[model samples]
Target: MVFQARCEYGMRMTSAPDPFHIQEELKYLRLHITNFLSYQSAVLDLADLVALVGPNATGKSNAVAAIKLLREIPIHGLPIAIARRGGFDQLRHRSSGRPYNPALRLDFQFGDNPVSFYELKLRGMEGKRYEVKQERGVLHFKGDKYAFTNNAGTLGFTEMEGGHRSRVSGDRKIPVPAGQSAVSFPATFGLFIVARVLQLMQTVEINPALVGELQEPSSTREFEPDGSNTASVFEELTSETRAELVDELSAIVPGIQRIELRRLADKVTLAFVQELSEGKRREFLAKQMSDGTLRAFSILLSMLQESRPALLVIEEPEIAIHLGALRTLVDIMRQQSETTQVLITTHSADIIDTIDIDALRVVWSEDGASRIAPVAEHTREPVRQGLITPGQLLRSDSLDPASA
Candidate 1:
């Protein structure tokens, strides 16, 4: 029912460890983007909070799409992933009267001063072979590390001296064809603990079409991208957490008092209803919730899983959420951000108005580049006056025209 823009994102590190328990680390998403037809350059420093607001077709979704593009490469085969989303030609933008550079690079910071950087130059594929024009990855530890690439043979370190570096490389760089991503190679064996946090927290995607099967609550099932398992997730919650979630959800769906996640007849299912109602709140197969309710449930539930993700990427968090519930949605999201880096993209002025003035970024597509810049200056007065809402400021001239 909601025709929303599509989005994509990524997260990964060298070791495989959940972020909640790691105490001595910091995670961030920084990009030095260029080569699009516009000659426009942007270094989007995604930190504690970042927001991009712009009009339709302004590339707000495109940037998010790139991130998801990167993530899907690892989860599903890249070809299938791309096709499922929109296909290759759709991936590139028509710019500068011609396509500019299609290169991409990312630098990830971890620990004290250690950093890991990956860069890839994407080009057209010839038949089944998409020759690599240039590719490189580096690990900086103790101020010294190794570098590897398809072009520049190993200069210093090829494999991590202490860990299994070769296996990581084979999966990340070896088999990926051109016009694709290496880190997203699911077949790739390495899952760095740090990288996974950022990646897992990367943008979230939901397919509304999948809602049909999610009508009922699913206690034993994992959360579906579409959020069909929301009722079940709450059903499985401890009494305390369930109370909290119910309190929160009640703010949105008037009757939704409690959701039960239970396994009966050897099957996991979700059960729920208006806190004030008597009969079945509603029986959904997990696919039956209103698009809006399901989307909200997805956001709330996903937060519980992170415990603490270095970065949390949310695509169109505003979709399906009622304008009235926008404030509560932002409040909970901010609460989650206290422990995880949060980045969201939305067109709703209401959603934008609630964001702290200092924590805003506006993304756009002009000329050819997908660019993002701080909207801090734009948000100052409104924040001080406490007049316009965060969401309003985000959508007003206070933000980019696309945002306005």
Candidate 2:
């Protein structure tokens, strides 16, 4: 008997037949923003691992917030999501006493096929209401393209294939209500790819304190953004997976023997077993563990989950962790990026040191708006000459366009 192995983004192939095949899919491509938060207009070409770096209040978190809001659109609908964030006025950027409409454009690709793009523009209307000024969806594949545009009270769709053009005419006009996305309409066909892509994007804002709290045991495999169900999720992992996590945790922090999820009466909590001297072991409850330890555990669990999202946005992962553990954490993030795209915001020089310059996006403020640039392009000479690490360039303020 022979076992056939399948290759995945992060898994290692062992004892498998024909392991050279590559499964490449475009999960996320590019994000363009205009008049959104502090960005008048900015575009980010997302990679597997992206590190956003800059000083405080430079809109690092704002970028994450934009993605988060976009993630909410498919679920809660555009109007409700905008309303939850204090309406369109607050979501849009106001500069120089001029009212600016907010716009977002996303590009997604599906497994070596041509790219699909979604563009949405929102404007504040009379009586504190907001309207979707323009919405468009385009899909290009194999020299053929399908596109639809909804603007100025009219909706139209076009299909171009083999140099022939056809319009969706004669009662084919889809009626997309104001403040709604055309992709969300049930009548729309061939746009499920865009919807599926949006569904896979996730933003995680972990709170270490939440990890310490008692949680009800559940069979959930997906970890929440706040890490509220970390203990329950840990309980769901198989023994082999749990052991792997323990090994990773021990590697990052010495003296950790094992992790146990114990259910007490009606509550479940995590316990960390530390190997004591003289061949003894001591157990510490989640509350007794250090902040850094709990935070590290949350991050490790998120990365090691069997079922994960396509894109994971983590904000400020360097908080409360020991500097010595930054390398291990960075390594875990990089490894996880092989399977899932990771976007991280950090102010730690140590975290920046472990990242490649190409993975670094220098975020800064210019003229009351936030801007982002690739670190290599922003700091050309020093990076090209190998004279400075990204960490060093950050500390020396060489990545700041305003300073230059």
Candidate 3:
């Protein structure tokens, strides 16, 4: 039940519109994993559109989480919140002991005319504050190579072919210390390319259908990780655009029509105004819509309208959606993939049943080791015959069989 699929390699994907520009070719990105969950070893070339499915706890979300964590590290990798959460000790595989022996590593290759490759090895150490034990950073491009200019806990670089890179700390020349990830070292001295790549690789794009956002209140504004921004976003739309969106949305979602955002005595809230025949009206305040319906709309709007992002990870989308919405969600998901590489962890058989089987990778976890297996028609038989539903299978005991 653990999805494991070997990441296909030795192939080239023509570049996409530059992610930096709305219409320019998005830079083609290749997300590869040599050894990851349910895969004795696996590597996957994420395409513009792809889908993944497996039983609950079979490690479906874990795969997406792994990718999310990787992209987040160089940025917020060292946030104080992590330390508060039991420090770096809690960062590694919970099952694996100190040293986090089998650390996950990611290799990146970018550019053209010359081409280049960079690798990041994540090593966790034993200490009150979990620190990185080793990081070997290098750049190979234009028939020349440079080593990780090392500094105190950071990785750095200098003139490879007389071209000055981004500046680091202290001076206009020096390598990064070993203590910090070369990817995250401040861009004062020089490691600019690495800096740019890390900057560009900021967020993980999630499959729209499965993405969820819960409402949270705060004095300040923030991008809701779960995407609770639809009503807020709609409130700002032009009257014409707002009307079109609501009209189309209500047609698909049923239960009447119209939506209004109110600034009440102290806070902002959404109101769903429904009209039965002949002006027979009803108002299901944001407080009135089912948690699931509100969540569904928020998820749909965010995915359908996001301007740009580094990556997106959609967790089990089938949870709250009806069968009819499932198909509509799929249509939009594939359309977005044309410009963004979206990853999804889902369990809805109805959704996957209609997808290209090869697009999915079943995942399984055991003894802290995760494996990814490609879902062949044959593989689905066991999952189908377990005579089980996703709800029951996810909560099953005896799942961590040590050597899955």
Candidate 2 lDDT by residue in tens digits, 1-404: 11111122122112121121111365688889899988998887798999988999988988887887776666566777787677788889988967688999888776666788888898878766778899888866444566778784356766556356644332356566667765554233334334445646777777878889888776656788888989987887789989988888887788898899888889999999999776888999997888888888888888777556678888888998888787998898898899888999998888988888778888888899999877655475666678877778778777654233
Model 3: number of clashes?
64
Model 1 error, position 93 (Å): 3.2
- lDDT value for model 3: 0.47
- The lDDT for every candidate, in the order shown, is 0.55, 0.74, 0.47
Best by lDDT: 2
The candidate 1 region of ten consecutive residues with least summed lDDT is: 1-10
lDDT of candidate 1 at residue 33, scale 0 to 100: 54
| Model 2 lDDT, residue 64, Cα | 80
Clashes of each: 55, 0, 64
Cα lDDT tens digits, model 1, 277-340, are 5664554443455777766666776666423345667877877778888788788888877666
Q: Could you give candidate 3's per-residue lDDT for residues 1-404 as a string of tens digits? A: 11111112212122222323422333434444433333223444455555665556755554554455454445454343234334454444444332342234444443332323334444544454444444444544433344454334543444343244432222333344333455454342123343344333322232222222223333222224454444455555567755655655564567547777766665556677777568688887676666556555654454444334434556766666788876666666666666555667776667765455446655665555555655545444555676543334334531222123
Query: TM-score of every model?
Result: 0.72, 0.84, 0.66
> Which prediction has more favorable TM-score, 1 or 3?
1
Cα lDDT of model 2 overall? 0.74
The candidate that wins on TM-score is 2
